[model samples]
Target: MDQETLPPNKRELLKQISSPHNPKEESLGSSSHKPSPKPFWSPLSLQMSIQEYELLKEDDEQCLRKYRKQCMREMHERLSFGPRFNGVHELDSGEAFLEVIEKEHRLTVVVVHIYKAGVKGCEVLDRCLDCLAAQYPSVKFCRINAAVSGAGEHFSDNVLPAVLVYKAGEMLGNFLAITQHFSDEFLATDVEAFLTEYGLLPEKDFRAAGDEADVE
Candidate 1:
């Protein structure tokens, strides 16, 4: 019988055996796989010269200095309130209140009222401050207990209900005995007007988007 008349499997085996074998193909399919070529090495990659090392060291120092300066700028931005102040916050201790005046006052206008307990004048001002705090979120309003605020005896007698204003860590205005200016029956508007006269409280924000930056 002719090879073409043989079964398909036998025909294929005979054809492969009669064909010339390829050594390159056999090696490609061998048991062990070939490893990749090694990369060329440059002297600069292996070891640095003394001058190069010094230059690298200088570059590292300069980079470190820039990083430190960036961190400090971020810290200043966080403290400076590039944004304005929020609502009122009560200080837990005298130290905390002083810290705010020393560190945080630089950011925005700080209004601190030293109040004594059981004083009708202080209570009236406190209510006024609550109203203003809601209206003017940009100004910081705080109240401290005169007795517990480490203020000397002088504050207890004379400066009860005193409103101290600060901007940029400097005392701008000190209004003592606010009751002398207005009676306890005064409303929030009265207190606002008084503070506005001293440039403590800004005008009411009537812009459409109150939180947006005002365009020039």
Candidate 2:
């Protein structure tokens, strides 16, 4: 009985059975269900061999010796201002790093140091670093290698190439600076907020970012 198909109801049933609702069908679901890329500032271990470690240790000693030889009074600097992130510390099992949580909260600043392979870390590096040294020095500033780790977990690749401040073992929670680009006022606000939280500064009227830009 081929009268332009057996009947309307029968034809519709055949179509429904042959073309079932397919998950693979387009526009049937949310586009944003895909996972986000990890933060770019994820912790990474700086790779080095035993000999390299020895060399660094020896070199640091030599620098101290030179400082001693050159001056009658020892002039000091914050050479290792923040937690040493040679990868060993940042990637340690959760238990081992718990000590940091208890340690008095100092500003733990992580600078997502980015440099093209074969590039030198010099003046230009300092230019970008103004937000750190001038704006957020009260925090202990450390650095991490960004190019090596770009996975998009909040602390990994998603913000790749980001500068983050952590305090009391929580990322972003105790932070003042979380990005590479910031205006002076924005930086000042966060720093002031952090300093207040730590009771390092008074309750009001602090100097702001680039206050010295005009002088220099």
Candidate 3:
């Protein structure tokens, strides 16, 4: 195309070609035409410096450590003392049984041994509970004479040595004549093992007691 009819870009190219070639001048011209480099710090990086980031990360780690320590302290306190129950109590009337299981200790677990006066197994269970009561003071242990307690209607000669476990006013376990399930010679440890397996009792105390006994 004629110079006058050429496109603006072509006209510019022709002018560059016609100009005298000087390596020093060309190099300087090209460097000036190149785009300026980006700044080292972005807008976001300027907003949050490295020191601020480090401080924030450190605060978060401290909070996490504090929360962990608080949790561990609370758990240790719970395990140290646990729940407290006086030794085995003998219920005299139906009202007394109701009070122990429903009203007075409804929020706690109540283990009741229903027994007849003549059953030998009942005697063994009573002794075992007495020992267990001392070992686990937080768990309520009691006995209701099948013949005299107002709950006599729920018991009979066939149901002697029956054990009922209640928590929060609900029956969690109903073991009828558990002596029949184990040998007549079974002890409190056997009863503890059975209850632990059912998740009714925490197992840590048993292990801790064993450790203490071994050390002694």
RMSD of each: 17.2, 32.4, 14.0
Candidate 2 lDDT, tens digit per residue, 9-90?
A: 9976666677646545535574526568977553343344556898999999978865654452222113324332222123
Roughly what TM-score does model 1 have, to 2 decimal places? Answer: 0.55
User: What is the lDDT for 131 in model 3?
Assistant: 77
- What TM-score goes with each of the models? 0.55, 0.26, 0.57
Residues 1-216 of candidate 1: C-alpha lDDT, one tens digit per residue: 699799999987887788676546665785445678877866776566666888999999978866776676466446545455455777767897788788873556788988888866888888889888877666788888887677657586556789998877899889988878886589888998899988887656332123243332
Write candidate 3's Cα lDDT for 128-160 as tens digits.
Answer: 888788766667889988877876777777777
Instruction: Provide the global lDDT of candidate 3 against the true structure.
Output: 0.77
| Alpha-carbon runs more than 4 Å astray in model 3 | 1-83, 105-107, 204-215
Comparing 2 and 3 by TM-score, which wins?
A: 3
Give lDDT per model, in order. 0.75, 0.42, 0.77
Which has the greatest lDDT?
Answer: 3
Model 1: number of clashes?
A: 0
